[model samples]
Target: MRSRRAPLLIAAVVAALLTPAAAAAAAPAPAAQAVVASCSAAAWSGSAVYVGGNQVTHGGAAWRAKWWTQGETPGTTGPWGVWERTGTCDGGEPPIDPPGTEDFPVSQAQFNQFFPHRNSFYTYSGLVDALSAYPGFANSGSETIQKREAAAFLANVSHETGGLVHVVEQNTANYPHYCDTSQPYGCPAGHDQYYGKGPIQLSWNYNYKAAGDALGIDLLNNPRLVQTDSAIAWKTGLWYWNTQNGPGTMTAHAAIVNDRGFGETIRSINGSIECNGGNPAQVQSRIDTYLRFTSALGVDPGGNLRC
Candidate 1:
């Protein structure tokens, strides 16, 4: 996770891309050290990977492991727990493009051109790592599904935060605000509750609490923590993505594909009208963002725009 202050700076970068003068004026920021690790099955020994940093290592069987920065507990260790079974790596289905493949107006190069900064935050390798860590989406489909879905998620995030850099920054800010005024634990004064953070822009203390609770973190006290912690923010996003109650179930990508009214899905997640704000225009903007991404990917918009 990156800091919200970072996105304020990124806005300038985005502006630079829009104009030659801005680009000329822009100075690159210092790059952070990238984290890397290698692991092997033999490092595991024979014991399960604990939630903290403990693991079993025995003769011949070595399960190498690394820490997931975001969702760290005293006992949790790796992305995939040794006790858990991930079934087959391959589900045997040939990857197929979703129904409206022809509606997309942009080529992959054009998509890259539109969001060149995305490569800075999330590379293809990072997305593959995310998919690998999240077992629920591991068998989602073939490479096509992985690519398209990752692109869609990235597209939505790009629109929400202006780009991955912005997402990282805003997450650092922890998007303070209170969508639910009736609650006593609403956002503090002067904090822009609606600003939210991350690609989904999760706003409001309640949402923070809920997301934290789902991911087993104390986000209410440290909302900004999501910015510096990738695994935490990623897991929080995944929890929201997989949960069914809000904005429909986390599994409702097909509904989104059908172009169904997705503001309702967002509303379901937020449990408030703030998600829709009773404003058709704002809702439509979000819908358009999704459509534009799909269209860029050469997919149909699916006509479910009844927001």
Candidate 2:
């Protein structure tokens, strides 16, 4: 039996988009390579067909096409897949945006533009404060790459929260069901405390525990902090964005920095649910939002916009 993909996103994100990684065992884990390649190399494209010996960069690594192929994602593609692991390439380090806002790549005005109707709970200051936790959030690669990533992230955030209008999940009926009594730690904060909350709507006791542990916040017993503190809420969102592999082999951060395109970000967030014809409407919605955000930021949306 296949293991369920780590539902590493907000309640709304998981429920609506993410699903199991039924083929997790198929690919071997990709390791970072020592022979660094040029950061300026063109990244692999899902839409373009490749023949033997063609090369591209993806997920911080260099890859060479073993034979003719198309649409096979790197890193996650198995050893038998058309592409072979070459070596690690320079993905880039944190670079400040043109906005000159300390560390966050998105300017306050840009964020406000993206979510003008956003709840007061989703403060710009709160998000900026959370940037320290993951310097790589939108800080990797070229300025255009950085802004594109920022747009991709916020686009999904907008979709999950309904343009940042809803801070919590609309369905309170699913609240108590997120707890897993089998977890040795159980639900110290009561069975219903782990309901969806914050910008992306976190839920489930295990997820709260995992996010809390990573951020050094005791959320297992005080899951409501995600609902009360805007900074902490944004931290959870960043933690998932930077660290969790979600339904894919790489994190969303890796997807953008490595030039795997925005569609890989969608796959990382939602498994195959909204991709591969599972839900074209949802995929189109995300792409539309991403395009809007990228346009607002004055950057090209790049290739492979769909999953």
RMSD of each: 22.8, 24.9
Estimate the overall C-alpha local distance difference test score of candidate 2.
Answer: 0.80
lDDT of 2 by residue, 62-151 (tens): 777778887665554458877677666665322223333655557664665567567889987788888888887788889888998899
Q: On a 0 to 100 scale, what is the lDDT of residue 62 in model 1?
A: 25
Clashes counted in candidate 2 amount to: 0
Q: Model 1, range 1-307, lDDT digits (tens) per residue?
A: 7765756778887775677766556667679653222223223311233442333222222222344222222122224633222222223221223333323233333444445445244433333333433454423554444334444454445655665546544353543434566767665433543456555656667777788787667777677655546556555555555554564443434434333434434444432443535655545555666666655556554443433
Candidate 1, which ten residues in sequence have the lowest lDDT sum? 86-95
Q: After superposition, how far is residue 80 of candidate 2 from its true place, in Å?
A: 56
C-alpha lDDT of candidate 1 relative to the true structure:
0.47
Q: List the candidates' TM-scores in order.
A: 0.44, 0.66
